[model samples]
Target: MKLEHRIGQLLLIGLPGPQLDLMTRSMLQTIQPGGILLNTHNIEDAQQLVELTATIRSLIEVPPIIAVDQEGGRVDRLKEIYSPMPSADLFRASGDAAVAARMGEIASEALRTLGFNVNFAPVLDIASDDGANNGLKGRYLGSNLAEVVRLAGAYLEGLQHGGVVGVGKHFPGLGDCALHRVVQQDQCSLECGDRRARALPGLRRSLAAPLVAVQEHSHGIIA
Candidate 1:
């Protein structure tokens, strides 16, 4: 690839609508971004989504990483057309690794049918029972380090087995902080030394796994 094209491949961009407009087509034709992140705003239905993704693929030489945040609960992008999925809390509550793995497989197949190759999911954050204020909340796997590790590993395996890439998110943990609703108060900051120290052991355990990748969230390193 040319240097310009190579540089473009490093970028993962977002679209505004259900279809590719002229400007978007031109940009994709020229730059050929490495991936695209689809959100709720860009999806109207299953058919429309498939067409949109197809159009995007046709515009580029190599296939882009078509990603969506399908972590279930409040973060699903395909819920309008697909069946509602149980939150991560449910998986953790079940205490069955097989069930969690099955959920991952089901979610992955659904995404694959819609032309999505990547899912921003299997949130590995460990949140407490009183973590309603935490950014992860119901999306987290579990508070126990051992349970989190086992379930996340199984979930990731299922996702990959079903032909979709699973991305584990919010590294170094997000359980200690609330979701940021505004920027003025710096509520999103991860500067609490104690929280960082407390989270390190779990973070190290998660990093030891060869199957997972760190997601880019709140200054968290993507490994």
Candidate 2:
């Protein structure tokens, strides 16, 4: 492969619109991105989403990483086509591993059918000590390290069962700094030091190298 091709493969870009027009196709062919992220704007309905993803995959030379947030709740990009999923806190509240696993399975099956190989879900971040909304409020499973690990593990289990690669996100937990600061500013670790340290234990327990990379199967291959 050419150097440009290798560099292109490192990118996971979002599309400008739902359909891939001539210009978009040409850009994709040239870039050959490593992945395509599914978002609300790029989605219209079930059939359209399926077609969009399929077309994206076909346009690229190598197998690309088609990813989605798919954390359910307010973050559910598929709410238009599929039922809204409950928040992460709700699952943690139940303290049921099966529930978490089933949520993962539900998300995985849907993504697989839609041509998505990667799901940017199962957030491992523990809620902040201040209990501020901090961007990941609804997304976080819980603050308790043990419960967080347990539920996240169950969620990963569910995702793996459905043959989808579950990507655990926000490593070492990012609840300490406000979401805005983290997004807009650089080195925004305000009051995040002690709390982030506390959160590392849970991440270490769950998302170690072995757990993060589950399968190398052709179906859910990620770059």
Candidate 3:
């Protein structure tokens, strides 16, 4: 591989505008970027995204990976345009693996229709009642390891079947930090040994699905 290709592999860029289309095409042709991460800002409509992705991919022999944070509920970028998604905790509360699976599939379909190849989903972070919580509240499945495992598994399964590569995130347990505020957890030094144990079960389950990768959060270390 060329040095240009090697450098491109390290970038996970956000899609800018039409003016940059030529530049974007040139970069992909010359460097072959590793992936493209999308957000609500990039989403205008399903058709637009499809065209944009097609244009970008045309520049390379192999299509570049396209990623998005379409975790569902409040985190869903297409919530306003598509069906409303349930929170991860809701799936856990229902204890219905089928429901979780459906959610993932639905999310995957929505993303794929918009030309995305990857989804940052199935948050495996366990939530705690403590003030130092890191679960991201409604975004979390539940505090119970068993519930988290089941729900995340189902969600990933759906995404996989829909041809979307799922990514489980915020490793080492985000179960004990406050939301909104930037609270970091040192997973390597948590006093509560149970936190690691609780989070692992979900991580293991998430990985068991057809996932592409797992994101190590910026928070801190993982033992």
Order by TM-score, highest first: 1, 2, 3
Q: How accurate locally is residue 204 in candidate 1, as Cα lDDT from 0 to 100?
A: 47
Of the pair 1 and 3, which is ahead by TM-score? Answer: 1
Clashing pairs in 3: 132-176, 132-177, 133-176, 133-177, 134-177
lDDT of each: 0.77, 0.75, 0.72
Best by TM-score: 1
Clashes found in each candidate (C-alpha, N, C closer than 3 A): 0, 0, 5
Q: Which is superior by lDDT, 2 or 3?
A: 2
* Model 3 Cα lDDT, one tens digit per residue, 23-118: 666766887788888777777766677887777677655568888888876787876578777878678779898999998888888888878888
- Per-candidate TM equals 0.87, 0.85, 0.82
Model 1 residue 155 lDDT?
81
User: Which of the two candidates, 1 or 3, achieves a greater lDDT against the reference?
Assistant: 1
